[model samples]
Target: MARKKTITKLQILNAAYEVVRTEGFGGFTARNIAKKMKCSTQPIYLEFKNMDDLKNELFEKIKNYLKQEVYSNEHTGDALLDACINYIQFADKEKVLFRALYIENHLGIEKMHKISLDFAMRLMEENEDTKNLSKEDKFELFTKIWIVAQGIASLISSGLLPMNEEDIESNLRDALSDMILGARYSK
Candidate 1:
């Protein structure tokens, strides 16, 4: 008798991640994941208590993926600048995932905001340019840059704006410089 292949929870999660990555959260269902995994939904249900439980775990996984893969670029030696560039690139490259997370709010808006803020603050803490900034100043700077970066990312992801790498980097650099100067002078 041939042994039946057992599907693990990690396998189900990976399948689910691919579904979300390709089709956004709207396609994030057990059936869809099962189709991707070439398995039945029974394995998914057996591994996770419920779809909500799977979704909650998936959300955490997505968050970590974004933090580690999407926003950890160090190309420019400037943490904030690199993060902004990586975010915009991710938005452009992973349009479906970006829309599901930010445009459609599949990820809770407040949680996403907090995650972005926390990540920015951590980068700022490590940056010499922002290392000595007071908490208020840091917040102000982060808000300003985040707004600009988000706007650019939204436009690019929506296909309303077509920008090359140089233009994107230049615009973000200008915005970062302006925000930093404003924060410093306002103190």
Candidate 2:
């Protein structure tokens, strides 16, 4: 009978995240992951069907971690504006991780679809009183803010926009306020 490996799946995941966090998706190779683990790539291959399998697992983990790390109830706050700031701050603080988890297409678009929805829903629950909102209204508001904020974040990531410390702070505030106002009902 073949013996199971001693290395945990979590170790592989952590190594993968480190690769992505530091070097982006381009660095997420079996050799790189193996190097980070100081082990042969065979263990990783045995644990996962392939690199795609490992990457898929890492993708789910990234989503869950983002929810817990950046948008959990503790990160939740009393005001809509504060939540927006926190969202922006989370993006800034985890730029490389965010890029790996989000901006990169290695994990494919389906997973990103789920993550985007999860993020929007969290923002809705945190920033707005969902009990006061209709389902249609909730979807609209969430979609609106996410689309715009994601665009801004992408621009920031691409170096297309000014990302100076003060600029990021001020732009985040202004953008959050605009999104809030955009969510207001006129009728």
Candidate 3:
């Protein structure tokens, strides 16, 4: 009979996530993960079907983390601007993980895109300010906000953008307010 497994799946996944989080997906590999674990990749294989499985699992985790821990529930759909600010803050908290989450694509490249669009759509639906805008217009506007926010987070994470995290954060919040105003008064 095969030797009973010792390491837990959760433990292996945690190690894998840590490896990817610090090293970026390009740097992530079974060999690197094994180095982090101080053991062979056999245990990782045991927990997951293969490298793809592990990669997908990692993406799922980072994706869910972004949705929940980042912007899971906004109490005041009225606070659309505040919600946008909070979204950026979540990225700030988990910048590396966030970047990896947004880029990972075991299924295909567009999968990350769909996930981002879905999140933006949900936020648009919640914000009363954006509620009246046409779907396409609303998506376009929020996509801008999402891109700017992610770029800001990435820049800050990489030390390329330097500013008070708080002060610059307000810029995102204000951008949402401006969008609300634009939507409120259209040509």
Per-candidate clashes, comma-separated = 0, 0, 0
Q: After superposition, how far is residue 90 of candidate 1 from its true place, in Å?
A: 0.1
Off by over 4 Å in 3: 73-79, 90-95, 102-109
lDDT, model 3, position 79 = 49
In the range 124-162, model 2's lDDT, one tens digit per residue, is 665544535655766776677666667767777666765
Write model 3 residue lDDT over 21-128, tens digit each, in one string. 776676678888888888898888878899888878877876776567666655444444545555656556666655666544433557666766787777678766
Ten-residue stretch with the least lDDT total in model 3: 75-84
Global CA lDDT of candidate 2, please?
Answer: 0.69
Range of the 10 consecutive residues with the lowest summed lDDT in candidate 1: 2-11
Residue 163, model 3: Cα distance from true site in angstroms: 2.3
Q: lDDT of each model, Cα atoms only? A: 0.90, 0.69, 0.70
Q: What are the clashing pairs of model 1?
A: none
Evaluate model 3: give its lDDT: 0.70
Q: Which candidate should be chosen as best, given lDDT against the real structure? A: 1
lDDT, candidate 1, 1-187, per-residue tens: 9657599888988888889889999999999999999878999988899998998889888889989998997878788999999999999999998999888898798888787899999988898778789998899888898899999999999999999999999999998988887787787
Q: After aligning candidate 2 to the native by TM-score, how far in Å is the CA of 115 from where it should be?
A: 2.4
